[model samples]
Target: MVHAETVAGRRTGSPWLPFAVRRLLGLVAIFVALLVVSFLIVQLIPGDPAAGLAGADADLADIARVRHQLGLDQPLGQRFSDYVGGVLSGDLGTSFMYRQPVLTIIDNRLPFTATIALSAITIVLLVAIPLGMLIGVLTQGGRRRWLDTGFGFVTGLLDSVPGYVMATFLVVMFALGIGLLPLFPPAYTPRFGSASFVLPVAAIVIGPICTVSRVVRRETAVVLGNDYLRTARGWRLPAWKRYVKWALPNLLTSTLTVSGLVLTGLIGGAVVIESVFALPGLGSGIIKAILDRDYPVIQAMVIVIGMIAALINLLVDILLGLIDERTLGGSHVST
Candidate 1:
């Protein structure tokens, strides 16, 4: 009893489910490809595995014996198979330099790193969205050019400053210069009630918040300039409600994408900031691994960081699609 017009409308309206399913599958395949590529890239780095394991003075016979024991004599295909199997089984192989299981190293350090990343992201989103919205709304009146100019300058300055510089300046001013806190504590006990993590979290948040706020401000300005928003304003609706209903939804979709990029930037930035503050996060672990050339630790850290970045971007895209059906449906029709 369904007419052709009804069927066509249904098809257009319900296209999102199939499109979303395809995007999800694409995300999974990309992550799998990253894992395989990471394994191969790490294996390709030139080095004497035995020398990396044992000291340079280790006897040739002992080195050969160690290589044989570690299955370095196997073909590349077999090694790759073993690597994939081990990864699937939650075994990241032994660290030639650290002489411990790679999973143990990652497992021990994951909580601290996750906490820092989560805290930094929370700070960025919580602070940036409102600030950007305010700036965007005010600048729309043509009376706040100075404010907009000042905000732009400050954002650019913060974005240009590296995380380490900001961290160091904070440490000098807050800890050494003011003597209000300890000079970059060495151990992080990770107690929720403790005051230990406050400064470090603040340091990570500063650059990201400023950067995210700038992106949001720019995007919100563009969104507010759209004809729909202008039409809403002409309707004499309540100013705040008009912005909330019309401006924020569009701004936030774009902001979520910027937030993902900030999260990606956080991976590298956190390493330095965490190290400078001596937080026992994955960042510190990466620094130590580099100093010691712990191959498994380094590779595992890279894989974790890369996966996190990719996953955040994927989630952001999904969020954008879900929040704005117009975009999703439009893209589906075009495809």
Candidate 2:
């Protein structure tokens, strides 16, 4: 009979299964750590949840009663155990300010946050990838030094600007200065196909485009300089054909890795951009929850965002494994 280890050593059914299981375990560990840290950090914030619940003018007795009612009077160890257990059981607790379930609040705001994140990623990939490839190809050919310098300078400038600052500038330029679009209406109520999405999406895309393009350009340059690509050139292949058929496929591994990071950054950046645009998203909700010392809402948002980042990275890993079999513990497959 064949042993399991021998079967694993040979190019058997699916090498990816073991790697995927390991990655899943790692993700679960990260999620647990995130919850513990989030809970502890929120607890460390300097404020009384009881007071927030009871109001400033409330009598001492009222505050005491509120504390007891919310289980704030419980021992720290007990409270933590309860919190972790509740999270594992799909009970995120109720929002202190909204007096509603934390899950319900998140469910309502999730679509808006998701829309912004997704739209920004779509814009980044569509715009940055081609632009970066073109720039890389041009620079590799030793043409357009001035154009490369200009692009480098602009991307550098954009990288330095924060999301809110960029959002403000876009609003000033397009909405206020040009009188081209209505900023308030869209900021207040952003719709998928509406014009209001323009400014917000632009703001979210700016930094990522600069960052991802630079990475893609560098990677593309490296791919273009490879010996095989030189061999392809020795055959007198057309430039476009070489790039499309040879350079791009080789460049995808690195570009895809960078895309995962860009996706995570976009999610984080959306919080600030969403606030600046006055968009009704998790970012604004998180801000309000913090100011109000609403621990449930804050904890829930942190968990959701952390999960998103983890999932994106995980998906990128799986895709990388598929593209390059060596990543799944097998021999490298030729491109």
Candidate 3:
């Protein structure tokens, strides 16, 4: 989820260089580990990819040629080395099923996924955080206990519902019954600006917002009880000034951490939403690759998603450290 910047006592510590470098190295290790797992998973699958490519009627010669073309004929160690080298050099190889470069396929499909994910994240933060703030304030009076209880009940229900189920409900309400929007007809070219895109994006957003708002509400309530906040109230400060100058800075860290988790979850959870909406995005690409047994696309997608998630989490950590000098013990701020 995305968040608006709030005024805070300037963040302290050199959190950028060291934290980012460490995160990059960690991401490299994760990539290498994921590569090994991917290779083994494919190797252990019931059927041979080479034979799968060449049909049941094909002769040994055809299978051999297919194996050689796919580099399966090489010794396992040699193939592993080549795989690692190719990955390091950004040559993830071509897709046997798509008959296209893996990079090309990713380039063609990534934007739609990015757009949907970004929009969902933005929407979640827009709705969830403010609602959380409201919940936090209400809880202070002890007058709206049901408000939190009601929100908790609704969030639990939403989280329990499958993403596709939610997407279908939205489609039925907006597209079928009311005819207020198009039903995402097959082969439809996805455009972010289209009126039809809202429902699908909203489908992705609702579950995450419900989850995040709960956390934000709890954290904000805690932060409101901090010493600085208590002191601000003791001084009889204006409400708006107190929230802006004291309460928000302390609460920013919670927002960053929650947003990082939400973004990471979106990468994996977007598949059902993407398929339901017929959007040509990374989630759909992954489903297509799995059905076709396109190893290259699967491998590349896994690595890319892992890296993006790692980078976002690392950014959150660094920002947290920068935002609160106590997080760094005592140091100059990083750019």
Q: Against the true structure, whose TM-score is highest?
A: 2
RMSD (CA, Å), candidate 2 to true, equals: 4.1
TM-score for all models, in order of appearance: 0.85, 0.90, 0.86
* Best of the candidates, lDDT: 2
| Shift in Å, residue 209, candidate 3 | 0.5
- Rank order (by lDDT, best first): 2, 3, 1
Q: Name the TM-score of candidate 3.
A: 0.86
- Inter-residue clash pairs, candidate 2: none
Give candidate 1's whole-model lDDT: 0.76
User: Which stretch of 10 consecutive residues in model 1 shows the poorest summed lDDT?
Assistant: 326-335
Any residue pairs clashing in model 1, and if so which? none
Report the CA-based lDDT of candidate 2 relative to the real structure. Answer: 0.85
* Full-model lDDT for every candidate: 0.76, 0.85, 0.78
Per-residue error for 145 in candidate 2, Å, reads 1.7
Tens digit of per-residue lDDT, candidate 1, span 1-335: 45755655553446567667877787688768867776676565567676667677789888888788777778989987887787778787887766789888888888877777777777778888989888877887565899999998988888788778888887888878987766434565565424555667777788878888888888878888899878888988888887887788878877887787887788778788878887767889877876665656776777787777777777777777878866554343211
Q: Which of 2 and 3 is ahead in lDDT?
A: 2
